[model samples]
Target: MASFKIEGGHKLNGTITPQGAKNEVLQILCAVLLTPEKVIVNNVPDIIDVNKLIFILGELGVKIEKLGSNSYSFQADELKLEYLESENFKKDGSSLRGSIMIVGPLLARFGKGYIPRPGGDKIGRRRLDTHFEGFIRLGAKFRYNKEEHFYGVEADELFGTDMLLDEASVTGTANILMASVLATGTTTIYNAACEPYIQQLCKMLNAMGANITGVGSNLLVINGVDALGGCEHRVLPDMIEIGSWIGVAVMTKSELTIKDVSWDNLGQIPNVFRKLGIQFEKRGDDIYIPEQESYEIQNYIDGSVLTVADAPWPGFTPDLLSIVLVIATQAKGTVLIHQKMFESRLFFVDKLIDMGAKVILCDPHRATVIGHNFQSALKATTMTSPDIRAGISLLIAALSAKGTSTIHNIEQIDRGYENIEARLKSIGAKIERVA
Candidate 1:
């Protein structure tokens, strides 16, 4: 396993370009199965999950050509759907949650799809009942054997209809969108996930000839097309990475500029961070975070500690709450971090506390952080990463701590952030990867 050894308490000062969205790239790669013509996607992040998805696609006979750094041209002209039953499929498919998305495109074009239980961050029990529910609504029959943990879906002719998702699950929305694009009739999905990733998928599908409306809203209407043609599309910049950089700047009191950031896509993030006394200036498409001596946490109307919570699209992303929590430790006041989406996410706060952070794990879903204001540097220690966001949060904490810190199980960090240590090192972060 890879680990990060960081000599902390050094201010990070340099320019860094945020990588492309990992979530967007995964689904966009699956979108290639919608057509036989060539499709080129640029600004694709070179991360572990994306690489795993590419390996899985290659095993399925999709011709993927690397054009340049962060660019790839893919052609699913002669995809061998039967390869999905191979051991390669079983191993890779069950290794990540994004693997479930292949089912929709496979079923849409090949009339059958096979998937085992998808694996991802162990934050909570993410139910796929909504995904299967959407598929069954489109006239597909599913059979699952719990003993083998395999799921199969097939339909001779898929007919679309109106669907009201029980929850606006991101992967569930992508699954339905891919499947509905090729159905026999129109499909209306209400309470859908309308995150930037989903909107990008919809735009790419539209360019490929699938008629979709409500690009950034929770209601999506899809007019099924007989066939989708090929088209080139570039993914938008990752908003999560932009937010992470913003947190880093505030936490380390460093002046940094993030370029090519989609200001419009960063809905409510700037405002949310403002509540935590972090400010940034916008220069066209870039965000400039100025150096700060100290940051103060804004209180609520009743003069109590403010709480930051997560919600659906157009709301603050839950994935960023961990980073925000780490940043809060450097601010001058107390704040509550409420992670409504994942129960196990707060458990990692113990590691931060062990490093001399003032934190109270209120419960499985909430924590109260009192900033030390660098009164005392966090002592270096050895810790294990728990999940993707948590792993990155620990990395940030370790980077801000004193002396040396060793973080194990770095694969969790690789699952999301692209070349994180390298990127940080480029930005003057003293971190190295050790095997």
Candidate 2:
């Protein structure tokens, strides 16, 4: 296991470029299975999850060639569908929640699909009912085997139908889109997740001859085609990483510029930060954060403490709630963070409390943070990463602490952030990787 040893209380300066979005790359990679031609993808993040998905593709006989650091060409000319039942495939495939996406394309193309229980963050009980329900709506039959902890789906031919998802689950929407693209008729998906990642997937599929409308809204109308052709697509910038960097700049009182940030896609993030009294300047597509001492939490019109919460697209993302909570520790006033999506996401507040922050864990999903205003630097300590977002949040906390802090179980962080140590080092952060 690798660990990060960070020396804190140093200002991060210089311009940093955001890496490609991980969520987009995962869905796009799975979309390759729908075609037999070569798909050239650029700006793919070299993160652990992407690498795992690439390994899974290689196991299925997809030809993947690396052109450069962040460029690759993938051709699924000869896929071995039986590999889904292999023991090795079962073990590795279960390691990521993104693995569930393969089921849709495999079923749509090969008439059968098998997948073990997918694994991801243990934030809460993330059920796969929505995904399987979408598949059933598309004329697929599903069988869940409790003894083997596997899900099997089969359909001789998928007939498209209008689907109104119970919830706007991101993975569920991606799975349905992949399956509906090659169905026999049109499929209208309402209450879909129109996050930037989902939009990129839709755009890439459309470029490959799939007719999809409503790119950035809850209603998506997809006209199923016979087959998808080869297409080249560049992944969008990592907005979560951009948001994390914004938190880092405010917490450390640093002047930094993040280049190539998709300004329009950063929905409500800037205004959300503005609620914390942190301001930035937008130079074209770049965001420049000047040095600031501290930020004060804004109150409501009734002069009550403001609450920052997560919802569907256009609202604050639940993924960044951890980073926001950590940044709140340094703000001038108290703020309530309600993570409505994941039940156990707020449990990491104990780690922040160990670092001397005043936090009240209201329940499994809610927490109230009282800012320290950097009155005193957090003392360095040993910590273990619980999940991906929390791991990065702890890293940020360690970077702003007094002495040295050691963060173990970095694989969780690697699953999301691409070359995080290298990226932080570029901005004058004193961080080292150790095994």
Query: What would the TM-scores of all predictions be?
Result: 0.98, 0.99
Local accuracy of candidate 1 as per-residue lDDT tens digits, 1-435: 989999987887878788998888889999999899999999999889999999988989999999999999999999888787777678779998899999999889888999989999989878899889999999999999798699989999789799999999988999989999999989999999999999999999999999999889999999899999999999888888888888777766788999989888888888888998887899999999988878888999899889999999888999899988998888889999999988888888899999989999989999999998777777789999999888988888888888899999999999888888888888788899999
lDDT of each: 0.89, 0.92
Model 2 / residue 179 / CA error / Å: 0.2
In candidate 1, residue 211 scores what lDDT?
96
Q: Flag regions of model 1 displaced more than 4 Å.
A: none
Q: For model 2, how does the per-residue alpha-carbon lDDT over 1-435 read when each residue is reduced to its tens digit?
A: 999999999998999899999888999999999999999999999999999999999999999999999999999999987788899888988998899999888988888878899999989999999999999999999999898799989999999899899999998999998999999988999999999999999999999999999989999998888988999999999999999999888878899999999999899888889898788999999999999998888999899998999999888999999999999999989999999999988888898999999999998988999999889667788999999999999999999998999999999999999889998999999999999
- Misplaced by over 4 Å in model 2 are none
| Colliding residue pairs in candidate 2 | none
Model 2: ten consecutive residues of lowest lDDT:
373-382
Candidate 2 colliding pairs, count: 0
